[model samples]
Target: MRTAGGVAGAVLVLAGGLLWDIPGLEPAGERMLGIFLAAIILWASEAIPLVATSMGILLAEVLLISSDGLFDVADDVGAVPAADYLAALASPVVVLFIGGFMIAAGATKFDVGRVLSSAILRPLGGRPRPTLLGVMAVTATLGMFMSNTATTATMFAIMLPAITALEDARSRTAMALAIPVAASVGGMMTPVGTPPNAIAIGILADQGIRVTFLDWVLLSLPVAVLLILVAWAFLAWRYLDTSSPLALDADARLDTSRPAVTFYAIAGLAILGWLTEPLHGLSSSTVSLAAVVALLALRVMDGEDVKRLDWPVLWLVAGGIALGRGVGDTGLDSWLIGAVPWGGIPAALVLLAVAAISWGVSNFVSSTAAANLLVPMSIGISISVANSTAEVAVVMALACSLGMCLPVSTPPNAIAHATGLVPTRDMVRIGLLVGGLGVLLLSVAAPLLWSWLGLT
Candidate 1:
């Protein structure tokens, strides 16, 4: 059934491409639209492996959308050269992810993650409610600086023993479910914390709207904190009772050896550098690469540790970046802005509408892909309506970060789903509630916040 639906989506894309010719869109824009649509369907439907689908997008661009494609030429705009699209593979954002992955690998290998998790969680007492909130706090805090997937995995590893010790199955499952949700929400607190945040910043940068690391934190941190608290409440309400006993492994040891200390120092410096990026005038990618080199030089992480870095995620992100570049090269952003009616609608409604669309699409596809497709469209819409692009950009970033309704929605969610502790229907239920609240919060907060920040 899914395969047939994917096929039908592809057919609709081709049919739309051949038939729906808007006033300003040229031949290249039309073709790129079909390619983007088909890619989204394949990505959302799992007709092929997502990494393989990313490869297909690269192939499609090289063979059909590039300037020298054998089949077509640009009718009203300059065709994108192969070099333009191919460079996305090595984009700075990709380097940032690599650096982030290396740091996560180092933390995991040197026992930094385990030690930190133990220190935070061991003091939570053995009661179910306090223990769950403690676990969420630690995981969510780590997520603000590290990849949510790594944070979730590391915290879950450290917590699972305690989770297994719980006397009640309901409480155990709820505790497990909170790890990924907290991880996802925690990532919204910082730009480097997740791929969607970085992707949105990258797109906005191209349009002359520079979002610094601090800028992102100020705009998003409050929202993330509020959501994390709400998630903890939801999990507690559904899974815990006041009297449930939670005994944890008291023997968990914190590694304080010289190597572990050195690892901590390097990791701390890297995070400080990321936080003070504006002062240093260095890109986050450069800071991350430095940390990677330090980890290897100090022997904190070996060549084997490098092998454990998340390469598949980097590839997936690269493909999304490439697709966004294609949309720009073909003038699809402008074409989309022109096609949509944005005249009389209020700016707040525009944000709500865009957020709703992005949130909906993300439940079925990669959030990175949804950010790639929607951020640029939002940017275009902002310019068309003379609205604040910064406002639209925040909504795009937050909406993409908030999607976790399905097992297939994100890697962190997928990992949690694999534990067999969370059912699909339960995730759908809680995810819908949390995601709706997130959209509402953003829609209300963004306009007032951006205005105060003097952005609009």
Candidate 2:
């Protein structure tokens, strides 16, 4: 199946570039179209590793559309320098995620999550309902800083013994469902929280629209908090018995070694830097780099820890940035905008449509891939309609994170499903409810909030 998909993707790339005669599209646009189509096929089908697809995009752009191209092309195509493509690997958005990854790596190495979870859960006591809420809150908080998949995995490892001790199957299923749902929602709260958010930020940055780290948290944190509460309420009422006394081990001791203390200081300062960007006047990317340097220089994290970071996710984000730039530079965005009669549609409907499409497609493919394919178009449509590009970007990014209907919808969901505690039906039922609520909030309530705050 993978081989067939790769061959098909190659054929589409050739056809799009050489055979398809799209009127009004420049030669550069044709080449970009080929790369875009091939990217969609390869990314959606997983015919190759996602990082490979990303690297391929960079290579294709440099070879086919850059001024450094091997083949001659019309002067009207206006190819950019090869350095433009190569720069995606080190883009600010990628750098921000790199900082987040370093923090996560150090935390994992020193067992910070275990200590934090234990500390937080101790206050909530061992009653089943409150315990579930505490578990979810801790998971979501961790998800904001770490990858959702990693957060879910870590929380489950801590909670598994308690979960298995539950006498009721419904209670076990609810506990299983809560971690991934909260993690997915929590990932939308910060720029470095997930790949789709990074993709959105990077694409918007290319358009000269700056979304600060604090600005992102302001816009998304409320929605994330509300969604977590909604999921918790549903799970608590439907599956948990409030009166039941659940026993959880909240006794894990914090590591107080010199290295662990140094890591804690560095990680805490990094987060403080991100949250106080306005006061400090340093960009989040710069703060991220500072954190990275601190970790290595202080010897809290080493070269081996750096190697353990999620390089593939960074590459995937870089590819999306390059693809967005290609779309705009080659005028493919204009062609696509013109292909649809978007001007006649209301701005609200357009936003809703894009959000809906993002949520739906993300359930079937990787959310990062879906964001890569859609964010450029969303930005173009928002521009055509004289709407806020930032709003559209945020909506699309959050929508991508909202998909959790199937095990394949997200890595966190897949990790939860693999535990054999959550039935498929149980997952689908709660997934739809939570995902639907998220979409409605993003499409309706979020816009009103943004407008009221004069953010748009």
Candidate 3:
């Protein structure tokens, strides 16, 4: 099935670029659209390896739209050279994820997650409601700096025993549901917390919009906090019996070995650097890569850890960046600004529409992939509507984090479903509610709150 999809997608792209030409659209724009469609099919369907699809997109751009390509025309001196287009493979955004993966790898290797989980949950006592909240809080906190999928998996390992020993099945279910949802929402708090956020920042950087690590946290932390709170309340009220007490064991042995201590110290310094990026004026990517170096120099992580980094995701992001640039090079973004009906549409509605598209698509595919597809489109649409690209980027990034409706919506969601404690219907019913609340929060919070923060 995937083979068929790949063949069809490739055929469509090659045919559209070589044969079809839309009226009022430049040859480059038409070809880019074709490549864009092919990427959509390849990515959405997972018809091939995502990294291969990304490489395919790069090859397509070089062959179809780069300088002296099939779509090249006179007055196209400004065409992106194949080298410039391929440079996305080493983009700062890609480096950012590289650093993030190193940090996560270190944390996982030293069992930092277990220690953090115990430390946070220890304060909430053994009561059912507090226990639930504590677990969610810890999971979310971990997610703010690591992969939500990893955070969810780690928390599940720690919390499952407590959940299984619960007096009531409803309490077990509530705790189960909270792990993934909290992790997903928690990732919204920071740029390195999730791919969507990183992708958003990377795309915006192409437009000369420099959003610092602190800038992103200032714009998004409030929304993440609010979503976590709402998710907690919803899970408690609907799935858990708050009146009962949960007898959870909150014991964890913190590893205090030399390598572990070094890891923590380096991780702490890295985070401090990220939070104070404006103070030092070092780019987040630089700081992140520095951390990776420190991790290796200090012997906190070895080649095995390096090999375990999420390279495929980095490739996906590189492809997305290349595609966005291609759209700009081909004059599609400018043409889109004129072609789309943005004259009468309000800016807030544009944001909401992008959020809806992101939310809908993420339910079926990886949120990272969803972000890769939608973030670029949102930037183009923002140009059309004269809206704040920063605001649109933040909205779409957060919306991608709302992929909790199904087992496939996100890795964390899949983790929850694999436990057999959460039914598909329950996840859908509550996921819809959580997702609706997310939309509502963005609808009200993004315009008003982001403006107050100068993001608009």
Please provide TM-scores, in order, for all candidate models, with all chains considered together. 0.90, 0.97, 0.96
Candidate 1 worst ten-residue window by lDDT: 69-78
| Per-residue lDDT of model 3, residues 178-292, tens digit only | 9998899889988889888988888888889999888888887787787778878888888897776776666878888999988889999999998999999999999999999
| Candidate 3 whole-model C-alpha lDDT, 0 to 1 | 0.83
Give the residue spans of candidate 1 off by over 4 A: 1-23, 71-75, 454-456
Residue 183 Cα positional deviation in candidate 1, in Å, after optimal superposition: 1.1
- Pairs of residues clashing in candidate 1: none
What C-alpha lDDT do the candidate models reach, one value each?
A: 0.78, 0.88, 0.83
Candidate 3's TM-score reads: 0.96
Model 2: colliding residue pairs = none
lDDT of 1 by residue, 335-416 (tens): 7777778877887788888888878888877787788667767667887778788788778878898889999888788988
Worst 10 residues of 2 by lDDT: 70-79
Error of 3 at 341 (Å): 0.9
lDDT ranking, high to low: 2, 3, 1
